[model samples]
Target: MPVQRPFNFSAGPATLPEPVLQQVAAEMLDWGGSGMSVMEMSHRGKEFISIYEQAEADLRELLAVPANFRILFMQGGGLGENAIVPLNLSRGGKVDVAVTGSWSRKSAAEARRYADVQVVAEGSGRNIPGSANTWSLRSDAAYVHVCTNETIDGVEFHELPRIDNGVPLVIDCSSHLLSRPIDWSRVGLAFGGAQKNIGPAGLTLVFVRDDLLGHALDICPSAFNYKTVADNQSMFNTPPTFAIYVAGLVFQWVKQFTYAGLQGLAAMEQRNIDKAALLYTTLDASSLYENRVEADCRSRMNVPFYLKDDALNERFLAEAKAAGLLQLKGHKSVGGMRASIYNAMPLEGVQALVNFLKEFEARHG
Candidate 1:
């Protein structure tokens, strides 16, 4: 049997809620008397179709996604969408992107293959603008893309930007989806991989405005075309059946979540805010550990911190693991330690991490 642990702070392919995992385990052998594991079922079978429908419905209701937007269950992780977004939306026109950190930079570079990508705004995504007028958006640009949250740098855009030029705004909200409610009014399209707040790897969710459909460059694969996939209800190709089922369970779990008398994503959001606040506050107060990201722009999901003495990094990981906290290491590009407190992580988990941090500091101080 696998050992149970607590306080996981992994970046993607991250921790899942215990209840969701438990349900998955129980149904692994025989799903709903079908006598077949979900993984073994055909993607077109009744069991998988039921799973897909429930998953889609639950997600639509959870986000309060409008009728004008089609939710696609896609396969490629965020990296694949880096190209897909441009292929479907760019129309070979100029594309504008705000280069906040690693992910958006990659987006800009990939889009250059299909369109003229312009960096309208460049900075760490965390800070409030020195001046909003600094951006040079092209009136003829295909669409403006923003990361919204930089997973590696711990910078988050609390408010979505509004562009008056009529060009749609595309957001790479992969890291922070479901942590809080989205202002869909300002967003034209959004895509996120399910490894973070949703469920497991292999499931990608894309929400696109109805008016933006059917514009795919000839080079784009038929299965990847927004209109094609959306028209087929994400059946253009075989979907990630198992991952979708798990994500549906998570959606149900989120709906029943209660915090401060709120339910569903509202409750999840409040709890997430509280959990992030607790961890960030503790890190800020410690002299041994520090999070250098700007206060106003810090990510509520991924918190990357560093020890004043880098020599203690290995010891820190060993001790954190021994204390039942795992995957606290940061990304390789920006090395240190990172704590990803997504929606699945409860306030108690953050408290455990805080307690561990304090104890570690006291021992090494």
Candidate 2:
């Protein structure tokens, strides 16, 4: 038997649902009796095509995606989409960005390379803007961009900003894609890397409203063109076959998930709520640790906290690993600790971490 794995808390390329992993392992050698692994199958082959179609369909159902939106499984993670989005949607016109934290700031910086990007609203790097009304969006802006969840900053937008100027709202939801239901009426495009909430790293999921598909900047690569990929059913070129297969299994697992009498996405949202609450409650109650993000904007997926005594960082990480809680270190820029309680992180995992935090604080405090 394999060694029991520790609870993973990495920011991205994060943990996946256990059932999805087990199914992937079981199908590694012979997927569906096809005598070939999903990785070995051709993207154009019928078997792989079925896997792609089912994954897209399941994701659509799980999220209740509107019929008018096209879901495209493309390459290039969130950072890549930072550029690809502005290139495809900006049309070399003004683009408004709401800088809530690190990821949104990066998105704004990258958009400047393709469009005349404007920082319509800014945060103090610890909280989201109080309201979308504070933004100074231009009427001619092609679209407004926001990172719905900042993995590094531990801040999430509980509600999406309303753009009343007829500008489409494009969100980089890399860290919190499937944790809960999305309001499609307020969104024009939402994209994310699969590694966090879905499956693996190479796959990028993009849901774009039909109206936003055809207006790519002339400099945009043909492969990255939304219209081209949507027209070909995300097969303008060879897709991420293995990642899509694993993601398909994850979607199936998510569809069957149940918690507290809730099912599917409702179940997932409930569990995530419970997990984040448990962890945050522990941190808030402890004098030794602190989570600085505003409670209203706290992320249900990533939780970044700092030890009151910064000198204890090394010892905390070492003991955390010994306690089977891994990857609790914060991002380099942040310099503390982060616990990414994604959809795959069970309530028990958060409880375990809480127990460890209490024990450590008691021993050290």
Candidate 3:
């Protein structure tokens, strides 16, 4: 039996649902009597295809993705997709990138390798100023990239920007996928790594509108080309079979989840909202801790905060770990504490963290 671990809050490769882990463990040796573990099975085999198809189907149902969109289960984390997005879509044309935080900054840099990348908007603080109308978007831009949620900075775009230029809007939603409903009407393409809100580290979920396909530059790798992957059902190269299977199980789990008389992803999103609200409320009320993100743009998934006295950082982390809260240390760039309450983190977990925070402050204050 895998050891039961405490509540984990690592940013990526974070904690997964206990039930999903249990299911993966149970099926590790023999997947439904196929006489082979999913890991051992060939990606071309029917077993893996069924797993891929079901995962895609269930995710489509859960998110209400339009039929015109192709959900490609590819290999490559968010970092790899940074270049792949530009390679497939840029077509050597200009691309607009909104740099709200580290991820978008990296995306812009990677795209510059393939296209004339422009920083349509960049943020120095917690949020960006000016409206979409003021952005100097290029008419020849292939697609506009936006990091829907800045995990390190705790900035989130609660609403997608409206661009007057007829450019496809691409979103890097790795940290906040499935935490809320996406406005598919505004998004032409959205890519997310599975580790955050979906499943394991190797799998990447890319939703590309049908029209966006087949625009790959000649320099684009055949393996990373969206049109090629879609044509072959994401099996052009052996897909991440095991990760896709686990993600399918997670999608099933999400579809069955309930909250406040709502069910499915809507319920999961509402619960995420409530959980973030509770933690933010506690942090804001406390005198010793401060969350720097703007109230209007606070992230519902990643909450980064600082102690009033930086001297207590180590003590805060050590005590948090001892109290069954793990990985509360923030990213090194930000230098504080970050609590990533993904879809797997229950309300009870947040409540426990909140309680520990209050007790720790009272004792040390």
Cα lDDT of all candidates, in order? Answer: 0.90, 0.93, 0.91
lDDT per residue as tens, model 3, 259-341: 99999999999999999999999999999999988788899999999999999999999999888899999898879999999
Least lDDT summed over 10 consecutive residues: which range in candidate 3? 124-133
Candidate achieving higher TM-score, 2 or 3: 2
lDDT of 3 at 68: 95
- After superposition, the stretches of candidate 3 with alpha carbons farther than 4 Å from their true spots are 1-4
All candidates: TM-score = 0.97, 0.99, 0.98
Clashing pairs in 3: none
Model number with the top lDDT: 2
TM-score of 2: 0.99
Pairs that collide, model 1 = none
